[model samples]
Target: MKFPTVRHCWTAFLLLLASGLSAKEVPPPPDPPRLVNDFVGLLSRTESQALENKLVAYDDSTSTQIAIVIERSLEGDDIFDYSFRLAEAWGIGRKGKDNGILIYIAFEDRQIWIQTGSGAEGFLPDVMAKRIIDNIIVPAFRQQAYFQGLDRATDAIMQLGSGEFEPEGLGKKKISAARVIFFIVLLIVLFILLSRMGGGGGGGYYRGGRYDRGGGWIWWG
Candidate 1:
């Protein structure tokens, strides 16, 4: 039997090193006991049970899954990537619907990520996700109200997912449109009253001989 060559030994050494690195970097996915996984001990027993019950009821009613995971650290991994991996590994949502949301909080890393599965993206887009974190979760977290933040954020997600109400931004847009329409109508009414007050002579208009209306400019005769 011929001994292994120097190149063969070096190649084997490199392969072993690569395998070890891979094992270290890519840790095994978490096996959560329930929908709420407080690996970091952020939530108390009562809080965890309350959150889990809410999540379970929401899933039962709508068939959409929402999971909350609080970890002490991400082990230097990117929060977004790690959260996505966790969601995939756990299969949080139904198989075909894929309507799942993962709320991941890393205490040491000081990061929060909301990962929505494909089917749930319509209800919870990236912008809305950021809004939930920035507007809802972060504020409560700043006050050290972890459970409150998680509760409110999850409530918002469930409401949006179930179509109980429009997303905040979308709702704001609708309100804005309604305001614009009201303002336009008010302007039209004011213009008509002013025109009547001027008494019959159409030559003297608000601005030259043209009126800038909603759709386009109208030449006033």
Candidate 2:
């Protein structure tokens, strides 16, 4: 009987090796959170409403708190500069890079106006982000659910905004989440150690290899 050639044997071996290799798992995209404090520059703009000290509501019809950014153009060499007027027309108006903008929001003519910056990275998409603010942030504010709306807005911001040098959002100032976790673990270890001080006479865990109630040198039962 005729046998397979060397090339055929090589091909068979390669096929077997490929089959043995498990498919590479495509990891889910990073969802790091974005906070306002991360930005190098920060500004807030608020407008006064001629109302008494009563509760004020913010909805699609009334937006109480809003933020806006005015960006400048980056030269051909300095790639950090981001365009003001983008193709999507998501209120990316023109204004030289001299100034950054901040706008306190108020709904008008059934439409929301947003200004994004070349600096902000990983933020909600302009149009969608605007919609989220209108539908979620505003209503939550009206209901006094400030944290809820703020959390949602923050999460969205991290996903769509842009960065200056690093396309990722800015690193937070306070302790990182990992650091906080490590601290908690350390605290637990300390607590356990303190509890197991074993203050003499059947104090520590396991007195007589089983259990002895009398607080003495546990007599073998």
Candidate 3:
């Protein structure tokens, strides 16, 4: 068998190297700024400072931690997965609360993901998270106003976390008196159902004393 030419061998080696590189996983970018990490250097010094101050204030007041990260790209990793991992790695929230929130933006991919920890889910659920991205962040991003987008989005998130932010129109709907009354009625009905299920008529006497306490039969020693 004839040996391949040197050029052909070099080309094959290059192809193999490329294949290996493609299969390798790309690690997440470093967190130099800690609070607001712009790995791709997208934000200006002033913009970064402003965002850092906003987040610091938010944390100080509510103890709810929020982090913003902007990367040129995540290579091949899914943003949702990357966000969660980054939050976990950074320990963004308090130890016991797990209330961290991560705002991940991939510029090249044109994708964003809001990752909320267990503690934050109460304040920022899936719907609210998506709304902030779709309405607030995406709009600014489309206009090529990254700083504005990040600033507004962060403010909105902080407000929502503190229960102070409410969007107009759909988000501003107040609970009517009728709805409040209906909710109370529903709770009363649920309580009755649960009581019936739990109270088994006190059929068995534990200690030979049948005690009728407040219209409910109780058997105790």
Could you report the Cα RMSD, in angstroms, for every candidate shown?
A: 18.7, 24.7, 20.2
| Clash number by candidate, in order | 0, 15, 0
In candidate 3, what are the lDDT values of residues 93-138, reduced to their tens digit? Answer: 7788777788887778777878777777777776777777777777
Task: Please list the residue runs of candidate 3 whose C-alpha ends up more than 4 Å from where it truly belongs after superposition.
Answer: 1-33, 169-221
Span of ten consecutive residues with least summed lDDT in model 1: 211-220
Once model 1 is optimally superposed onto the true structure by TM-score, how far is the C-alpha of residue 138 displaced, in angstroms?
A: 0.3
Worst 10 residues of 3 by lDDT: 212-221
TM-score (all chains, Cα) for each model = 0.65, 0.24, 0.65
Per-model C-alpha lDDT, please? 0.71, 0.31, 0.69
Cα error of candidate 3 at position 101, Å: 0.5
lDDT of 2: 0.31
lDDT of 1 by residue, 1-221 (tens): 11123543454356446545342133354555479988888899999999999999998898888889888877755455456657776778878887888888878778787877777778887677877877778878888899998998888887777677565553445457889899999999999998789886566336642111110111111
| Model 3: lDDT of residue 53 | 87
TM-score of structure candidate 3: 0.65
Residue-level lDDT of model 2, residues 118-212, one tens digit each, is 32212322344445556555666567554455455444443333231122232324678999999999999998897699455654455452112
**Model 2: ten consecutive residues of lowest lDDT:** 211-220
**Model 1: residue 183 alpha-carbon error in angstroms:** 16
